[model samples]
Target: MGEKHRSRWVETLVLLVRNPMAVASSLVLLVLVIVGVFGDVLAPYGYNEQFVGDQLESPSGSHWFGTDDFGRDVFSRVLLGAEVSLRVGAVAVGISLVAGVLIGLLAGYYGRWIDDALMRFMDMLFAFPALLMAIAVLAILGRGETNAMVAIGIVYTPIFARVTRASVLTVREEVFIRASRASGAGDFRIIFRHVLPNAAPPIIVQTTISLAFAILSEAALSFIGLGTQPPDPSWGRMLSEGRGFIEQAWWMALFPGLAIFVTVLAFNVLGDALRDVLDPRQRSALSGKGAAR
Candidate 1:
C-alpha cells in the first residue's frame, strides 16, 4: 500500500512537471516559503531599524527597494513581512481545514437531519460576504494579528465545509464506501478510512486555493488597521503607510503590492495545476483531445 501510494505521488509529480505553469508556480511558491522561513537572516537590516539620513530614499545600489517614510528599509520590512503573511495564511487555513473537514464528514456521512442542521449553519455563515464577515468578526474580537487570523479562519470555514461536503457526498456513494458498511465497518471507520481518502483530492486543491485567499484577506484586514499592529512589518500595513507617499516614493507601495500579487498568483496557479493533475476526468479529457487532434 505504501509503495502504491509512493508510485501514485511519483505519477502526480511527473504530470505536474510536464506543465510549465505548474513548474513555474511551484518554484515561485518554493522561493516564497524559503523567504518566509529565513526572512530574518535574509533581511539586510532590522525590519524596524531607521536610517536617519535615508528617509524616503528611492531605489539605488545601497537601498535595494528603497526606504519608507519612517526611514525604515522597505526591502527588509517586505522580507520580514513574508513571515507574517505566510503565518496568517497557514494558521487561518489550518483552523478552517480542521473544522471544515470534521463538519463536512459528519454532515455527509450522517445525511438527513444532521446534514440539514450543519449545512444550514454553514449557510448562515456563507450569507455574509467573506470580507464583510471577517470585518465584523474583527470588530467584535478587537484588533490584533491573532484576532485577524481567527476572523479570517472563521470567514473561510464555510467555504471549506461546502467543498468538503460536496466531495464527501460523491465519495460516500462509491462502491467501496457501501462495501465498508456491509463489512461491518463502524461509522467512524467508514467515514475516515473510505470516504475521506477518496474525497481528499478536491480538499487538497481547495486548501492551496484557500491559502491564497487567506493571505489576501489578512492583507485587506491589515490595510484597514484590523490586522498586524504597528512596529510589526506586514505587507498590507506597508501598503497602507505607503499610500500617502505614492506620488513621491512609489517603491513603498509597489514592492509590497508586487509581493502580494506574486504570492497570490503563484498559489492560484498551483491550485489550478493540482486540480488538473488530480482529476482523472480532466486528464482523460486532455488526452482524448490531444489524440483526436
Candidate 2:
C-alpha cells in the first residue's frame, strides 16, 4: 500500500521513539498543539475576557498562571497564542517548502542557464537580513497575520531552496539516476521518482527547522507591532507587553518565552535526529563502526 511504502522512508521514527528527551518534548508539543487547536473549549476563560478583581493576580485556584494587566487570564491567552504560533509556523514553512523545492529542483537538475540564474537570484534574496527583509515586505504590504506569514515565508525560502538544490545535484550523478535516464524514462518521471526521493531527506529536515524559524519570525514581527495585532493573543505581543511589567508580573512573560523555547528546541532536536537517520554517509559510518567493534 502507498501508506506502508511511505512509512518506510522514515526509519528515523523508530530511533526518535527510543529517545526519551525527544519523546518528552514531543509529548509536550502535542499537548500544546491540542490546546491551541481547541483552545476555545479547553481554556476555562475567554481569551480576552477580563476578570476585574483578578488583575495581576498570582496563580490561584480561581485564576491559574495569574492575570495580565487587564485581568485577562494568562493561561487562556497563552493557549490562544499557541494557535497563532502554530498556524504561522505550519503555513509559512509550507509555502517556503513548495516554492523552494521547485526552484531548487529546476536549478540543480537542469543546470546551464537555469541553474546560474536561479542560484544568482537566491544569492540576491539571501543578502538581506531576515528581520530587515521581513520588515521591508510588511512595510509595503501593511500588517496582518497573512502578510506576516508571507514575510516569514520569503525569509525562509532560501534555506529550503539551497538544501534541496544541493541534494538534487548530489543525487543527479548517482548511477541509479544515470541508469534511469539510460532506460529512456521521461525527464519528468526521472526527476520525480528517482531524483526527488533521494533529494527529499534534506528538504524535509530543512522544513522542520524552518518551522521553528517561522514561529520565531512571527513572534518578532508581533513584538514589533507588525504581526497579530491587538487582543489577538500572539506570544510575541504578549512578551512585548509583559516586558514593561517583567519585575512585577513575571508569569506573563515567563510562560510564553518558555513555550517558544521548548517548541523550537523540540523541532531542532528532531531535525538533527532525522538528519542522522536520513544521511547514507552517517548510516554507513555507524554500520562500519559496528562491524569494527
For TM-score, the strongest prediction is: 1
Write candidate 2's Cα lDDT for 157-216 as tens digits. Answer: 887789889999998999988998899998899888888887888888888788878998
Residue lDDT tens for model 1, 1-293: 45776777787787788789999999999999999999999999999999998899999887899999889999999999999999999999999999999999889888999999999999999999999999999889999999999999999898889988999988898887888889999998988777887789899999999999999999999999999999899999999999999999999999999999999999999999999988988876655655576
Q: Which ten residues in a row have the lowest lDDT in candidate 2?
A: 1-10
Runs in model 1 with CA error above 4 Å?
A: 1-6, 286-293
Give candidate 2 regions above 4 Å deviation. 1-10, 285-293
Steric clash pairs (candidate 2): none
The clash count for each model shown is: 0, 0
TM-score of every prediction relative to native: 0.96, 0.93
Displacement of the residue 120 alpha carbon in candidate 2, Å: 0.6
